[model samples]
Target: MPWEGISGLVNLMGTWMTEDDPPVALHDEKAYVATPDRRLVFDSTSQKTLETIRPEGGQPVSTLKRGDRNNAAPPVVTDGSSPLLLAPFVVRQAGTGTQASRTVAELVAADAKTGKVSWRLRLDVADWTKEVTDSLAISDVGASANVAVVTLVKKGSETFSNPSTTYAVDLTTRRVLWTQETFKASVVAGGVVAGTKRKAASDEYSTPTGYDLTTGAERWHDAAEYFNTYLRPAGPDLFYLDARDRAGGKNRLRLVDVRTGQTRQDGVALASRCRYDGVGAVVCWGRDEVTGIDAQTGAPLWRLPDEKAGRVAPRVSSVWHGRVYGKTSNDCIRPRPGVTSWRTGIPSEIDLDQPWSLECRRQGKGRALAAAAGSASPGRR
Candidate 1:
């Protein structure tokens, strides 16, 4: 099939005849397509093959490698000059019984243009027992300044026991800068924001920690204990929601200064689910309301109250330019008072003016919001 007129297939594995496969668009008019054994870059306009990229050392490493179920799409980062691909390779040991397999996770960087391997770093595995099966998967990849942040989840056989680790790699020198261990982690502002959970007999809460992306040194740690919290990249700051009460009881929406580890403002109480709209605001939905907050300062910008009766609730799906696009639930709009719209469904958009209210709504039928033209959507990748 022709993918956006940017890529098409030539053949599939084990076939001499020409076939078609989906293509990955890189930049400009160039796209990458997979063959039986290698990946080829071709021009979309001219329909001419530009380059054939085979794995170095005959080891399979292409994101389009066939039959490799664990392969993930390599994240591409740029140093403001050229794109660099962060390729992940999984080496599984052959064993049985208590001798569980050992997985070697590697992070390799290659030049996007020449497809030449530049640097490789072996990611460390979490300490595991022989009886436990362990595996590692790349969860996130991001870059800021001269550092590239890669997050991996080291999972064992036990449920909910997996801990994610974040590694900061210096792109200029191609060296491992630092690493941090947390339940989850992401690149935020100029540093790394990591979260860890602690469970006690009386209380269970999570903490958000900040680290310097360059040196991998601990910058600041929050002393507050939250029932649950989610961290998101908000430009140079971190936007987070902390739930103190369960089941739509109460939530705090705040923006953290990644450098100072402080809230940009006294965060206001809002719903648990929220999305950053790339254009300097975040939209959150509750039982009967939708809200917009400034991404940088955490100040309330607008509020839309929905007094409609039923179990259906309004949800902000995506924000583009200055518009908040979302949908409304068809079930019970007001299933219960104080309930959130996190899981509710529907499609709608809200005007950003004061006393915000629904500007657009599609009842009964729903359509997913499209990405804003000429701008990237907010939140995290």
Candidate 2:
């Protein structure tokens, strides 16, 4: 499902892209380097690494007591005067008994130059994860410049752990704004969280609810009792929820605006995965074909298998800036890697001679496409 091999940098000028040699060729994991001064640092797990960039009197910060352990999550880089570095650190007093350890945690703020804690706030770890871990820690973090959402997960199987408690923090004031009761969050964008809620106590909650990411207020709910339980975000305020009839007939999709709920409902069955090109089109790939729909009107834009199937339809790698870049599905023949316009469903004239890798900006922009790579390729969001 992922592209493996070398990475090549190409610049798109319209219908053509000129290839260029990149300055560095690190593997996906080691593709980034942080710089405080003129020197380059790898940001290893060390207190010294934080003192690269900073501000004058970095503000009075709170500290974990002499024996308290701060289980910190990864830091999220954002723009603002809050702090050069912000991370959710779960601080706990040492103990080894039932239900593990401490529920105390802190969302920390600091400057890169001094690594001094600009501020810290106690976090509320959900009761769901109490029995799962002997200690509390932030598993992952998602944030904008002003708001941050941290996921506290439950012990899961080999595949992955599910989120139990999600906390939204105000980055500016270093305050815990609100908490969402989401067992699993699908997507968070434009201050909206769309995910499955814990209606009662069981983990079998299928109804996906859209909540205000900033305030954790319930905005809308989608019934996903049977067929499917996924919602693809079309915009900050708009998302597409499956509203198909369980009885039979043609499946339908409801385009919902979190502000007022349902906007436009269409009788179109989108693929299992869909990408909303920030523009006005939503490109989707069903099992055997690719389709496009106008995000606003919910009208069908185009679909593959209409004559030039092999040349246009790709395996659906990724959609960015309104273009879908992917390798052709019919690889048995000559593999044609192309970029198709999600709005038109027509393949671009540009040909990616090196189809070895795909580019995804997960951590930061420094994460380039790994060329001539290995087992782990660059991640996609």
Off by over 4 Å in 2: 1-93, 96-100, 103-122, 134-145, 155-163, 189-191, 223-228, 242-254, 267-269, 295-298, 307-312, 329-338, 350-381
Candidate 2 residue 190 Cα shift, in angstroms, is 5.1
Instruction: Count backbone clashes in candidate 1.
Output: 16
In order of appearance, the predictions have TM-scores of 0.60, 0.59
For TM-score, the strongest prediction is 1
Instruction: Score each candidate by Cα lDDT.
Output: 0.48, 0.47
Over the stretch 1-381, how does candidate 2's per-residue lDDT look in tens digits? 101111222322111121111111121222211111111112333412223222122211233222332222223444444334444444444555665445555555555344455666677667665565543335334455477666655533201224467777877787788776544555565567665565543534346576787778877775544234445555445566653344463355656664555656554545655666656777667566677777666667888757744434555545555666544423211123334667777764432333333322111222111112121111112
Q: Which ten residues in a row have the lowest lDDT in candidate 1?
A: 14-23
Stretches of model 1 off by over 4 angstroms after superposition = 1-76, 93-101, 112-118, 129-135, 154-161, 192-194, 197-205, 245-252, 266-269, 285-289, 306-314, 328-381
